[model samples]
Target: MYRYTDFDTAFVAERNRQFRQQVRRRISGALTEDEFKPLRLMNGLYLQLHAYMLRVAIPYGTLNSAQMDQLALLAETWDKGYGHFTTRQNIQYNWPKLGDVPDMLDALAEVGLHAIQTSGNTIRNVTADHFAGGAADEIADPRPVAELLRQWSTDHPEFQFLPRKFKIAVTGSANDRAVIKAHDIGIQVVERDGQIGYRVLVGGGLGRTPMIGKELADFVPQADLLPYVEAVVSVWNLLGRRDNKYKARIKITVHEHGLDEIRALVESRFAETRAAFGGHDVALFEEIAAQFAPPAFRNAPTEVYDAAYATDPVFRAWADTNLSAHRIDGYAIAQISLKAHGETPGDASADQMRVMADIARRYGHDELRISHEQNVVLPHVHKSDLPAIHKILKANGLATANIGRISDIIACPGMDYCALATARSIPIAQEIATRFDELKIENDIGELKIKISGCINACGHHHVGHIGILGLDRAGVENYQITLGGDATETAALGERTGPGFSADDIVPAIERIVEAYLEHRSGREESFLETYRRLGMAPFKLALYGEETAKKARAA
Candidate 1:
């Protein structure tokens, strides 16, 4: 984890001071609601349907025990008893009083966390693979580059207000766990010849218009990554639409203008961006990279882990689902599920946060991670410590063995909290999880991702789920639409919609029908839901969902 330097600390402190004054002015009636809107948004505060929401950045999803403890404190003190972890690997407090936000900001600043650029039309949090340093297949840790980008972008004079909000995700592994292809700017760390460089992608987004990123630069040397990224953003910043907010995204810009033209513009801009940095940014990157050096790992016997796995069925299930391969011999990366069967997808109670912090301190290498899938990760847990960690998590209601399963859904804070939402995403996600759990077939069904969004904004990343659910207001009633075969992995693809929208009452049954269809037609359990969907196409699923009559009628038409 990157520790905040004196300058970083001082900058955050100053920002907090300024925001404190801004909050006071709004409370004192010196600033009206309209006047306070942009100011509050710049600080990552949103006026939701019910209350004010505060989003705090977790840089590259890495944090220590102290930082996790601070998050728990914010949840316990300023907001509700729980915090919602988002797809961007950030956390949102849905019920914060307007006046207490500055205090919350100050508390976050103490832990080197802030909410800047989280909501505005600027470069949002620079995200990376949650298992960056720990993944077995990584070429290099992407967090150093992510941190460099974060430092460069935060409060940068040139990019504070772009035509639309931008996002960037980086991954060092060949497997795309970070969903980099769906970001405004996606960076993949690749080995070329003998050197590590970046493979840059641009124009990927997942709102009303979902797109997989195209290669902006096939290979950019590490030394030139910062300037090259700036060039791409700089080109889009000027070329992107400003008239209608709907078409303001860089995705739309790329759609309107050909990639060749965009490349030319970026190349022209890169010359200037490259020169301005000189060599200071590279030095800064090297400094930031050093801060992210892998923690000291221990060589330990895995007999305890093996023994526990053989003896305890509960531990076995959790371990099988939650653990990932770590780069170190004796270490494993463990994901703590926030999506318990009937609970909100990403909400973690303050006590749960503290429990995770304690486990990270005592078992993990004093480092904890928040996954983009809305789970906490102990990225460097030794195998011998698995049982004890599992026991503690089990006691705290964080030991759900449903990672990548149907019940382990990714849902946004929809109508329940978000003012922009049309229908309730939480209840839909809850119903689906509970129904699948009761059936007890989710484990047997194999890996599946079910993402739900309340609206077309795709906050839940429904566009990339194996079974994607999009909730909308049909006329005056709540309706849900289903999409099939979407993937967020290396072979990224947007889901295809299945005919008409279903009523809220019909959505769960529709999902069940699709799952049944997948089970019936799959080559074997070896083939996942996504594989079945892609292999058989939408025909079988559609027949199962809408029945033979509608399917035949549609096909004939």
Candidate 2:
């Protein structure tokens, strides 16, 4: 993890000091809620449905054991005893009081974490692959680049107040675990000939105008990344619409103005930005590269793990599903599913956080990572220790083993928490997960991503889910819309709307119907839900999900 430099430390301390005074003024009745809104948002404080929600940034989803412990302390002392981990890998406290936020911010700052840029229309947290350095398929780790972006965007005067919030995601792995396509700017680390570079994707986003980013540059050398990224943001900042909040995102700009036009503008801006840099900022890249050096790995036996798995069905199930491929031999990346059956999708209680911290310290080289899917990653856990770790996780309700399965859902804090949500999403996700667990079809169905967004903002990346569910408020009633054929991977494609939306009560059964339809229509047991959906199209699933009349109308073509 990148330690905050003295400059970084001083800057954060100053911000916290300023916020403390501002908070005092607000509480003393010198500033109204309207007057304090922007300041609170700048500091990542949100006045939510009930109380204020404070979102703290976990840069690039990376954290140390100490940082994890600090978060647990915050959850226990400041607000609720739990924190909701967001899809962006940040954590949110739903019950922080207005007056106590400065203290919370101070506490976060003490641990090299801050809420700055976690909210508002400014550049949000720069996310990357949770298993960046540890992933087997990565050409180069993307964490350094993400850190570089974080530094550049943090309190940058030029790009701070854009039309809307901007997000950037980087991934070095061949698998698109970061869901880069759903970000405003996505960077894929790739190798060209013998040198590593970035394949820059611009204008990709999910909100109202969902768009898959276009490849802006085929191979931007690592040295030129900062200048190039600045140019892209600058272009969007100047040209992106501000009058309409709906059209403020880069995705809308890309859609309204052609990709070719956006590329040309970015290139023109890049030329000017490059001249200004004169290769000075490139050294920061080197400094950042040094910060992200991989942990040393040791060879170990898999015999103990095998023996335990052979005996414990829980350990076997968790190991089979929760573990992912690690770059180092004899190591595995352990993804602890926050989306356990009937729980909030991405919430971890204080005790659970402590347990994870303990596990990371004991077995995972004293490091932890938060994945974009709202799961925790023990990025460097040895395969030999899988059984013991599984035992710990199982006792703590963290060993559900539904990673990428039907029940491993990514859901927003819908109406239950989010003031912007039209209908509830977490409960729907919970019901679906619980229903699937009851049916015992999760592992059998295999690798299905079911993302749910409360509204069309698509915060949950529902548009790209294998089985996308969008919740909406229809005439004082909650309704769910299902989309099929969506994918979030190297071969990314947006899922199409299946047919009419289902009632809130009808959604779980509808999802069950879709899964059953896939089971019947699939070519074989080897065929996954997404594969079958793509091969046969949405006709059969639509027929099963909706009634015959709607199915007939949908399949008419």
Candidate 3:
């Protein structure tokens, strides 16, 4: 909810002007594609398979009605009629023409949004918990620190060109909705003896080398937060690999050099960096925190919500799945499901965006959030407004009633749009979702996360899904690999891979076999898939995937 300051306004305007000129140069052939590539990337314009894609950052995934309306405009005017919400809490326009990117950037700037640092090997967008201030369990809101980090890293001279792109996420709650463990730098807001500080984690990432972050600092005081983070990034910037693009991430740096050594270096750097700040950042954080104060709560009766739950099956199902507890009594956080049955996961048409924006304005305190799970969040909807909101959401095709369920899949725009992808991810996700819908037993399955990535980049966060599916190219055919027992929560762990990859045609049936095994093996509905996997291990799931005969043969051998 932080508004752009005069400096922010002028800075974005100037950046847009520079990018406009760059676009003109590229179109006029003054700059070749090779020469223009970096420039366009810095502006969040990517040369995708068919056209240029523009990724617009929704910092900490916070947006107002006006901003959402502007995004809908962009979707309608420039690109295709829909926009894809990504795992990074950004929106991607897949069909923007190269010539029209400047105008798009200017449009975004008008709404106090930008594409700066959304791409390139610099610090990318700073993300936080989608339910930051509204979550009932939060110790303190993490967005103030997230905003501070954003301001610090945006165009920071020393970090403008790192060996690899850097990512940072923050969360105020213990539930870990932000997937902090899988980020380059993860900050958890913690209160120790009446003082709010941060529990910092470093070296956590997915992709080729998946790792759960190690604790960098158990407790960094609020005053020392910025400097401490800078020291960590500075050390990685100095030590991270530059020779191999694949291994250039900070996670690799931490993997090679022990955490103890990295901590020592960061501490040594922090001493100097801390002294230089001289409490300026502390004052700045206080100002930023003031901007994120919770909105006024309405004292309303929940009788309508209770009555609807009691009478309407459709509304009850949706309420059961999509609603989360809010910090304010009599209020709830409504998650708008982008993964509606067979639709492309995380995609919202222009009309859908407008509907969500309108709902937020009318009932959700004029605040909206884009969850890392690729869904829109009306973070502070009153319980009394549940029925009305649900009605509108149903009309807009945004009410899927599948939050945290089997069909609420997270998928990247794989070979369909990404040039780096070896196999398609969206179609696979669509097929699985459709199959699950046909089975009509998703509710019985319970709290399952199916994440898919086209390649090892792990953009879909497959590494931490309850059922992780990674798609790869095997001799010109798409082969999908499955991993089980992955959990992205306070107790974070990477999933173990199941033996042998399945062909694209067989992947859904393989998943069905695993689910059926879970249904048979579970201790009633009380035991979830993840819990069953944890207690029973991957043996049963493996047996289901490869058949009991194969398991017996392997045991005999």
**Candidate 2 structure quality by residue, lDDT tens digits, 1-557:** 79999999999999999999999999999999999999999999999899899999999999999899999999999987999999898999999988899999989988899999999999999999998899999899899999999998999999889999999999997788888877889999989889888989887877666778788888999888889999999999998899999988998888888889999998999999999989887888898899888887898788897788798887888888888888887889999989879999999999999999999999999899998889999999998888888888889999888898988899999999888999899999999999989998788898889999998888898999999999998899999999888887778888899878999988999999888888888888889988898888877887787668877887787
lDDT (Cα, tens digit) per residue for candidate 1, span 1-557: 79889999999889889999999999999999999999999999999998999999998899899999999999999877989999999999999999899999999988888998898999999999998899999999999999999999999899999998999999998899999999999999999899999999988989998999999898999999999999999999899999999999988998899888999999999999899999789899898889888888888799999999999999999999999999889889999999999999999999999999999999988998889999989999999999999999889899999999999999999999999999999999999999999999988898999999999999999999998999999889999999998999999999999999999999999999988888899998799888887777888888998889878875776
Estimated TM-score per prediction? 0.99, 0.98, 0.99
Q: How well does candidate 3 score on lDDT at residue 92? A: 97
Worst 10 residues of 1 by lDDT: 548-557
**Which portions of model 2 miss their true places by more than 4 Å?**
none
Screening candidate 1 with a backbone cut-off below 3 angstroms (N, C-alpha, C), the clashing residue pairs are none
* C-alpha root-mean-square deviation, each candidate: 0.9, 1.1, 1.0
Clashes of 1: 0
Off by over 4 Å in 1: 553-557
What lDDT score goes with residue 235 in model 3? 92
Model 2 TM-score on a 0 to 1 scale: 0.98
Error of 2 at 557 (Å): 2.9
